[model samples]
Target: MTSAPADSVDALIEAEFDKLDLNHDGRLDWADYEILIDRYRKTAGVNEDDRRIQELRAFYQLHWLELLRHSGAAGDSLSRNEFVEATRRTTGDTNRLDAAKVGGHVIFDLVDADGDGSISRDELGRYLQGVWQIDQSDPRYDFDALDTNKDGVISRDEFVTGIQEVLHA
Candidate 1:
């Protein structure tokens, strides 16, 4: 597969950093992660007491720690450049953290509103539109592209693989 150009990848990473820097504070901290986790919880309609929500919290905590560990920053938060570099290392280092697998599982759980094992088109659309505010008109986010088996829904494996591809890319 052809890889994206360095400039394009850097641009994408910068864009992702902007999104994750929720409060526009120019740094990524646990608070940003909490905001993201809360959004996922709201989208899933789960309360803080719910087991799944608790798991999601745990996942984010671990993920945040991993990012910090990889960042090599002196502070608790990561600057934009630090975050971009940390993300690149964390996503590429499967030995230390299988980000795609762990993140994909949690995200899939949140997107599967019906508690089903797979992601339906409607569920994905809702997730894309709600959580990330991604425009549904974007062809790149099409369910058909992710539903490799063409089974009308995206299986856990398919979803994870798609996430892995993006992370690596």
Candidate 2:
């Protein structure tokens, strides 16, 4: 359970801006800015059904508007670092929202690859690969950590509750 970096938001923002400034130009045209935001929506599950980019655009329209308003009349675009900080800060505190945490359900769904309401070690390995970007070949791929009770399977409760202790606080 690695802690999110102290500067996760900053890094996210910076990376986006750097990516948008493809030509190393200080300014971003509409196409350039949209490209960056498009990536964010897809990765964030704003558009997971392969729907049109407009669907993703609608998801971010209000949030981007809010961010712009928060910026107090920005320049050509939100700076790279600012975008990440905004995302991190805007995410609701998981501890405060117990209604199945914003992403906990998504993570659970991801782990339950077969839609079987629970996960086995193999399913977990694939989930970690797809969602958390973990490599199964990594030396630290300890299957036992998630297989609480040593039953050789990861019940939803075990995977969620066990990982939270180290990851949440």
Candidate 3:
């Protein structure tokens, strides 16, 4: 397979960073991520004790810590450049493809609402609409593309592989 252009990978990284920034402040902080988790929980009707909810929270926390560790910043926030650098370090790759894969996995875990190791169309649509603010008209979140196996559901591997393909194309 042909590798994606560097510009494409950079754009994907930037888009993912912008989506997580939430406040349009060009930085990611606890407050922004907290809002994200809370919003998803409320929209998805996930209870506090739900294992998926807990896992989401835990994973987000772990990712944040990893970012901070890589950035070596004293502040609780990560600028876009810092975020990119951290992702690169975390993925241990000079190319951004691995970072995109890691981000895709994180996104898969977040959107898989039922903790069943796959994402239903409903779960993906809800996440797109509620969290990513993408309307149904936006083909970016279409189930056909995400459900790479034509199974009507998106497994974690499918989701990550699909994302990688998109980013690398």
> What is residue 12's positional error in candidate 3, in angstroms?
1.5
Each prediction's total of clashing residue pairs, residues at least 3 apart in sequence or on different chains, is 0, 6, 0
Q: Per-residue alpha-carbon lDDT of model 1 for 1-169, expressed as tens digits? A: 6787877777778888887887789998999888888877888888988877787788778778888889999989999889888888877777866888888887888888998799998999888877777876788687898999998999999999998877778
lDDT (10s digit) by residue, model 3, range 39-124? 77786776788666676677677767777888887899988888877765655542423544666776676687777988998888
List model 2 lDDT by residue over 18-115, tens digit each. 65564465643455546654544443344545343444344445445544544543563655555544444444333333322423443565456566
Ranking by lDDT: 1, 3, 2
Ten contiguous residues with the weakest lDDT in model 1: 1-10
User: What residue pairs clash in candidate 1, if any at all?
Assistant: none
Give, for candidate 2, the lowest lDDT window spanning 10 residues: 94-103
In Å, residue 114's CA in model 3 sits off its true spot by 6.0
Task: Assess every candidate by TM-score.
Answer: 0.92, 0.45, 0.76
Cα lDDT for residue 53, model 3? 67
| Strongest candidate by TM-score | 1
Among all candidates shown, the one with the greatest lDDT? 1
For candidate 3, what is the TM-score?
A: 0.76
- The candidate with the higher lDDT, 1 or 3, is 1
lDDT of each: 0.84, 0.52, 0.75
Which wins on TM-score, candidate 1 or candidate 3? 1
